[model samples]
Target: MDALWEGFQEAVRLIVRGDAGLREVAWRTIVVSGSATLLAMAAGVPTGYGLARGRFPGRTLVLSAVNTGMGMPPVVVGLIVWLFLVRSGPLGDLELIYTKRAMVVAQFLIAVPLVIGFTAAAVQALPAELPDLLAALGAGRLRTLWLLAREAQLGILAAVMAGFGGVISEVGASMTVGGNIQGDTRVLTTAIVTETSRGENANAMALGIVLLVMAFAVNLLLTAVQQRRRR
Candidate 1:
């Protein structure tokens, strides 16, 4: 306990002093995680809505696949992404291997299902009268879905927060797809892992602190927003 406290204090001091390497890692984390979250929101929001409202023969199977993906191991995802981006791989021609874009793609994959599944849950939670109400008002399918989304805005926001939380802390896929290269793809989570393994305990602890603070801030903001929406 004493050692942990001392480590925490040291880490806070390093962060306060604006340690350059830690700052770089923090910035990269934000850039990669934010980009992935935004992309997931853009794509997942509508896709989830469609899944919730649209009927098809294989809809249940598709939903089941998404739910299963939500449990997929980070290392497995990293392996698949690494294979696809490796030289001689099908997508290797794009030269996206070991790039920030590759990390973004991996995190996007991680975030999408959370967004979709949670959004679907939110839509499903709506009153059954919702659809009938919209129909009585002559609302089309698109508009009705918009209404449903609005009613459950808080839930959807929660999904976004949850997804961001996952991606920001993810290391395996980011490290694999990003190569954890200094001054390029290095992010806070991967940096923590690297620094710790290299016996840079202070740096690892500092990066860990930053990651924790980011996670807390994200969840706090999500809670605040949801509460505000409720009122």
Candidate 2:
């Protein structure tokens, strides 16, 4: 109890003092996770729409893969990415391992599946005839997608939340691919882990608090937008 109280106080002090290291970690976390989530949404939304509306060979298999990916272990994804980016591995010539970009790639992989799965489910949940109805009214494919997306905006927003939440809180892939290097790829999650491992419980707790607050702030903003659209 005393430890928890102390940690909470420390967190408050850290925030009040405008700690540069804390700010750096927090900002990097947002950059990596936010970029990954945005990219995932951009690709996943269209892929999901196609899966929901188009009849094609192996569509079931692809959907199944996306579903499987949603539940895939973050460490496993990190390992796969590391293998590809590591020296002597295929594509190793790019030399991207142990960098912020590598972390983003790993995080992107983690977020993409969630985005795709949620998006597919959202698009699928709409009335099956919605697409045809729009087509009959002479709407082009892009316009029809826009309308369906608007109609299913709630689910799409949820997808964004899920994708962002998944990657922002994850530590394994970030550490593995980013090397948790100071002033480079270090983020809140990895920093918290490092602090904890060093027995700096107060510092660890402070970082954790910062991470939670950051996640909450971003989600709150997204939620406001979502609810506004609902209105």
**Tens-place lDDT digits, model 1, residues 120-146:** 878878887888999899999889878
In candidate 1, the residue pairs with backbone N, CA or C atoms under 3 Å apart (3 or more residues apart, or in different chains) clash, namely: none
What are the lDDT scores of the predictions, listed in order?
A: 0.86, 0.91
Model 1, TM vs. native: 0.94
- Supply the global lDDT for candidate 2: 0.91
lDDT per residue, candidate 2, 118-211, as tens digits?
A: 8889999999999899999999988988999998888888889999999999999999889999999999999999999999999998888888
Error of 1 at 171 (Å): 0.9
Which candidate comes out best when scored by TM-score? Answer: 2
Candidate 1 stretches greater than 4 Å from native: 140-142
